[model samples]
Every structure is written in structure tokens, then in C-alpha cells.
Target: MKSFEKELPENYDALKKKANYTSSWRDRLDAVTTLSAYQHEKVIDLLNNRMKNDTVFKVQTAAYKALVAFGENVEKPTPARFDVIKGPNKIFLRVKKSLPKDHTVEEFADKLKRMRLDVYDAFEGDKGDQFMTWLEERWAKL
Candidate 1:
């Protein structure tokens, strides 16, 4: 039950989704390891689910280690689901799963800059909402 020392990324919710649902166990294991680093209260709950229900043995073991790191007992987990935003939340989430996992506002801006695409004053003479729509449409193709 070694503690994870790495830091969790801001895209953690997405990564958690990736861990439990991705076909690639390597990615799932990576996601679990990253999530363990955070020790978020919900993280233990998620790890318990992973330990109990994951089809992959290594992932279950990883989750067990993570629970141990958090000083939680594996056999006595509380009934909880880590659906942090089943509807939505105080902080917005990027639920656009069709796009690349690591795409960011900075990269989006840089790409727009390189392509000379203007999110501002570019579509139907509307700036903000139109930009989001444009980005969504383009991101869907990625």
C-alpha cells in the first residue's frame, strides 16, 4: 500500500471517467495512479468501486493500494458514488469527450492563432457563444 506522490491533473474527472471506462487497462491503471495522488474525499470512494468492480486485477490491486494510502479499509467501504457532476456542478466541466483529452484553452487559442481563425468576431458577427459552437463543431471532428 504505497502512497502515490505524483500530483493529480486538473482534468482529473475526465481521467477518472477514462480510468473506469477506457478499454485500455494501461490507461486505466495510469488514471488510477494519478487519482490516488489527489486523496480527494471522493477519490477513496472511486477507488473502492474500482477495487470491487474493475475487471482488471492490476487495477483492483492499485485501487487497494490507493485506499490503503488514504487510511481507508478495503472491506468496509461506505456506499457512495463519485458521480461528482451527474447533472452539473459549481465549477464547469469539459464534457466534450469527442475531443482530445489534453486539449486546453491555451492550445485552442494557439491553434486559432496559427490558423488565423478568430473566435472573436468570426461567426455571424457574434463573438462568444458562436465561438463555443464553432469550437465544439471542430472539436467533434478531432
Candidate 2:
């Protein structure tokens, strides 16, 4: 098996190709994580779907980790007033509600951590044999 770093795709198309050919749990996980780094909403959507249905334990774990990394990278710091430079392929979260924009970087980091915790709480589940069975059922539908 190729190392995850060695197998990482260079672009969206490459990622898709790799995903299609992925035969090992690690390969699938690497594919999702590599695609997530691109930060494109389309890639994120694809990874999310895979995460939901991937029968491989490592692949799902990698997908979740990649999602966390994607959120952290894309979410702008608070004092910036939600002003964001959306990359050509990436999505940005817009702030609809007004709030105090005078926050230090440390505060922003803390807030990001809290937000991450909330997300984790929503997605928490056992990653055991039962989960593997669930994944297999889900994957069959996909």
C-alpha cells in the first residue's frame, strides 16, 4: 500500500480518480483528507457523503478529521468582522448577525475551539463493529 502522503491527489480530478480506484481503508481515508484540503465546497460535500457511507473505519475517521481541518482553515478569525477572501474553489461562512468584532486572536481561537466542540458533540458516535455494520448498510445504498 502507498503511504497516504505519497498517494495524495494533486487536484480535484485526481482525487476523484483515486477515490474511484481506492481498494484499501487507508487509501480511501487519504483520498477524502486530500480532497478536503482543497477546501472546495464540492469536495467537502463529496467527502461528507463518503464519511456518512464509507464502510472502512479508517476512511470515516479520516473524513471526520478532514472536515474539522477544513472548517478551521475556512472559518475566518472574529476581529476580521467576518470579512473573508473566498478562494476560487472554496466556500466562506458569512456572518448574518452582528456582534462585537473586537476580539483578540486568542479569544478567536478559543471561540473556534468551542464551535468545534459543538460540532463534535453533534457527530459523536461509537466507531466499533456496530458502526462498521451501519456503514456497510449505508454504503450498500450508495
Best by lDDT: 1
User: Candidate 2: deviation at residue 139, Å?
Assistant: 24
TM-score, predicted candidate 2 vs. hidden true structure: 0.40
Q: How high is the lDDT of residue 3 in model 1? A: 48
Cα error, residue 79 of model 1, in Å, equals 22
Tens digits of per-residue lDDT for model 2, 12-116: 686776654433444555677667556666677677766665544456656666666665333221211211112311110111012135544344334433544
Please tell me which predicted candidate would have the highest TM-score against the true structure. 1
TM-score of 1: 0.46
Which segments of candidate 1 are over 4 A away from where they belong? Answer: 1-9, 76-142
Per-model TM-score versus the true fold: 0.46, 0.40
**Candidate 1: worst-modelled 10 consecutive residues by lDDT:** 83-92
Each prediction's RMSD over C-alphas, in Å, is 14.9, 18.2
In candidate 1 the C-alpha lDDT for residue 121 amounts to 19
